[model samples]
Target: MMGWDQLAAFVVVVAALIVVPGPSVLFVVSRGVALGRRAAVSTAVGNEAGMLVQVLLVAVGLGGIVERSALVFSVLKFAGALYLVHLGVHAWRHRKELAVTPEQERTTRSSAQILREGFIVGVSNPKGFLIFTAVLPQFVSPDSGSVPVQLLALGLICVIIALISDAAWGVLAGTVRGWLGHSPRRLSFIGGASGAVMVGLGVKLAFSSRP
Candidate 1:
């Protein structure tokens, strides 16, 4: 068990990390801009749900195996990269659809599909797995209690903070979407831009090396 002092410190560190825009944040923003607030928030929830699964795996000790094996890590990374590229290309091709009514945009994709997509992205994120493997153990106090319990607790805290932060970003982007919803051209542009961002993120992730 982590003490109040240790937990507080961990929260501060995690909050700082969450505030900085990362892959998760960017993905959520894109969803908000392209889909709407509901989709963005749902994506955030699904992403965090996937993150929670990772935390559970880490607590059970499988995370270390994935972290230590370069082949496994690379495989996961490429899978995520390819998935993002696939998503980006699909979005770009259907960008014109976004120019329709905002109501239509909101109803374009079911919540389940968006959640599934987000979950896959979250789970396949190798960087996120590495972060958990590397950071959670640092705060574990072997003498205090079970290391797995502590890791789970710390990981939950991280996810909560991220959810709140990512949701806020999504809401903000959705608001922007509302403002631009009037113009079909601008809406199409937003769709295109969001797709481009996702594609760029995928390319960047593909080139990233093990750290």
Candidate 2:
């Protein structure tokens, strides 16, 4: 039941927010650089799907509960951090394999695993709850009849914007990766660098304090 004016404002705000690269963006781009555009897009979709879960919880009024519970937030954060670390370690160990033929890489790494990793990265990020709690309420009008509906609508918009924006990053990174893949030595270096980025992100997340 939000008016056009409100909807337009919300869109602008969310557009700005989505354009600011965050952890999700980093993960998607890294996957693109390491794997390819298809994997990157799949990861973006999975990440959005994971974010949808958070939106649902917020719509159902559980967002406050999550925000208030340090234990719950810590668990989610750690789960995401550990998953990223696992991915980094796996990538580092298989740098040589990464330099193999594209067909061989596809055979070794399944699409399902890539998507699952993206979903885990999405869902386990505790920061989503904070954003939902703080940002969604501002767009909800008292006369909107249903706050939950408004939250869902706004959350969907955020996710859609993010999907589009993050996909762009993926495509750009994938293109660079394609060029880099011309040489086996360069490909190996690319793999190692991507793994290091993931590990660094994981370590940063693990040590991050609650907001």
Candidate 3:
């Protein structure tokens, strides 16, 4: 069993890591602004779902393989970045259409589509996997009896924290988008800007130097 002190310490470290804005947060914000609170929340769920999967993989030892293999890491990295860029381009192309009344927006996307996009974005993000590989094991102790179980417990904690934090960001951005929606022109601007940000994130990730 993991000690209470270890668990509390782990919580603090994870909270600190999550509060800092990262790809997941940006993705949620983009979805919030582009779609709405519903979409944002859905995306957050899907992204965390992806995080959950990565954590599970780490618990099983697959994460270490990915971390050790430069080729694998690069492949995952580029694939995720390219996907983000694709989504960004798609958003830019349909910016005018996206800037619509709330009612009309609902018709533009189904729940499943939003969920799938969020899942893909979350799963593709190599950073989450890297964090699991690098950071999750640090808090674990051999004395814990079952390292895998402890990792899973810690991972779940991380996911819960992320869902709360990222969901808040989604709600906040969605509110701003709602306010901007009063003007069709401004709505269009927000959509385009969101797309631009997504593209920039993709490009940055694609070109980032591996550690």
**After superposition, candidate 1 runs with Cα above 4 Å error:** none
lDDT of 1 by residue, 1-211 (tens): 5678988888887788667886678989998998888889999998888888889999999899899988888888888889888888888988889877656755777889999988988888775687689877888889978888888888898889888988999999988998888888888889989999889888899899888
- Clashing residue pairs in all predictions, respectively, total 0, 0, 0
TM-scores for all predictions: 0.96, 0.95, 0.96
lDDT of each: 0.86, 0.85, 0.85
Give each prediction's root-mean-square deviation over alpha carbons: 1.2, 1.3, 1.1
Superposed Cα deviation of residue 149, candidate 2 (Å): 1.2
Flag clash pairs in model 2: none
Q: Which residue pairs show backbone clashes in model 1? A: none
User: Tens digits of per-residue lDDT for model 3 on 15-108?
Assistant: 8888788777898999899888899999999889888888888899888989999998888889888988888898888888866666887887
Evaluated at residue 175, the lDDT of candidate 3 is 89
Better of 1 and 2 by lDDT: 1
